[model samples]
Target: MLKDINLNAMNYFEAVARLGGISKAAEELGVSPSAVSQQIRQFEQQFGVRLFKRDKRKLTLTLDGERLFQTTTQAFRMMRDVRSAIQRQRENRHFNLRVSPSFAVRWLSPRLKEFLDLAPNWAVRIDAAPDFSDFETEVVDLDLRYGEGGWTGLHEEAVVHDLVLPMCSPGYLEELRALSDDPIGQLRQARLIDSVKTHYRWDFWLARHGVMGERMVYPLRFDRSSMALQLAADGAGVVLESSTLALDQLESGALVPLSTAFEAIRFPAYWLVCPSRHTSRRIVRIFSDWMREAGRVHDARAAELITGLGCRIREQSGRQLPGEEYVGE
Candidate 1:
């Protein structure tokens, strides 16, 4: 509500004052000198005050014009500062990512370097835990969640489906192979590593194979899925969890996927979660696309390994556990 404050007139006044005359300002503005004079005349008429004191050869600012010029210069200076700040922000590539603890250790930590290489100037700040800080009021830029979608006030994009199955150290696999040439039968006797985080337990997996829950032997339990998978990698026991979570161990031949006699565990997929406003952000979308491609690559690699190890169930009837692109729902 700035009464009688015409921005266009103010702009012309500032230019004429800074350039020292109407003709010079007109040249700078790419307009005729009469146009600049007309705009200034509109200003003086509206204000009922003279803005310039004309002499024989040169024009000088009136007392009123001098006071207005000070304010005009300061206003344009602030505008310049704001524009510079915005441009600097456009150049900055730091991103804040919040992730579940299990995914961070098992998946993102190992592969993050590759994504960083995609954008050399970009740096990421990761906050890992079971839950992330609230995105509504917090500064978290993006998040990953393992859940069924259908939340309000937030944007959700399902990135990848988590496939879980029994896996253990290579030496443990060797022992199981010795116990029986029959894969499913020997897995029943193999020591099981219990993960307290997920619902996929030794008993549930064993019952699918017609073995009673009590028949499966488990000597240790870990509260986090990553910890349980780590124990399995260390050859403590067999772990039933996300292959994507145990990616490093599986890739390094530390842990081997067991026979697919028990169906691979599937639940709601992992989602790329963000505030709705951030959904359109270039960096956020770039990261989302990068991760989706990463998920497909992991699925293809897992499929290749599963086929190589003779663990792929023909009943699954797909080339691989397929990856998915995000849809805003």
Candidate 2:
């Protein structure tokens, strides 16, 4: 008898008993009156008892039906309470974040304290990895990704439009200038530090400026932008890197523009990516808003720094430029 009990039928019966009419129950459940009537009839047949006593236009529960109704009501109320508790816990407890190592260190680490202060009650967790988060398997509430957007089935918005340029230590720039007066000659003779995993490499910057046919050698190479920027800051070599990641080094005078021959090339460097459902959560929305505002502030500061260096910013084409021949070693 316990195995044969239908929860759906019990739910329908509970609705009809509480609402006093089949139509009222159906309206609340978003179903037809006939559907509710069928379930109630099946529920009665299963128990071999009359769950409802029908009058001209009313539904009153039998003694057996009243007893069952009390149990069902208590059970449903408990379930609803559990669901609400879980939802509240998820929203108020912690926010999980995923981002690249370079971004985490250079961009987010310093600013994270501001967010923590804003929500002191919430615990924040960060996972800095190159791989994108699998929202299905991971407990990621937000993902700050570096890409051109268009992630399938996820909501993605451009958070940072970063510019790429060649930057090196002030001392290194002086040495390169001493080697040759011409910008192209200095770049050819000087060691270029290669950020091996960057989309906008030294080759891309060179090709965009039509600095072709000259063999450019990259003796120092690193997969991470942070390492490459550190190398450049230490006066090792000029590194083609994102202004967003190199903002601190630039501001501190540890790194300066390699040349003013070309403008900084713009690209959508960072994106706020998450599923549609998570976007509605209060904590996620608050954090996202803070990040967007922070990006705006950072961009303004970068603009001032670039203008101070006697340089300008320009948008680069999304398609790759045609000059890979000059890139070697």
How do all models score by TM-score? 0.66, 0.70
Q: What's the CA RMSD of model 1 in angstroms?
A: 9.2
Relative to the true structure, candidate 1 reaches a TM of 0.66
Worst 10 residues of 2 by lDDT: 320-329
TM-score of 2: 0.70
lDDT of 2 by residue, 1-329 (tens): 66779989988988888788999999999999999999999999998999888888778889999998999888888998999998898676988998888989888999999988887878889989887888999899988987666678999987777878899999999999999999888888788999876768777667767676656877898878999999999999989888889988888899998888768878777888999999998889889999899988988888788878878888754534343211100
Which runs in model 2 stand beyond 4 Å of their true positions? 1-92, 317-329
Compose the digit string of candidate 1's lDDT tens values, residues 1-329.
Answer: 57658888888999999989888999998999999999999988878999899897587999999999999999998998999998787678688888877877767888898888776766678888676458768788898876555556788887766667888888888888888877776777788788765645566566666765455777887778878887888887788887777766777888887665555654445778887889788778878989999887877776676666656433322222134222211
lDDT of 2 at 2: 67
Q: Could you list the CA RMSD of all candidates, in the order they appear?
A: 9.2, 12.6
Q: At residue 12, what lDDT does model 1 achieve? A: 93
Which residue pairs show backbone clashes in model 1? none
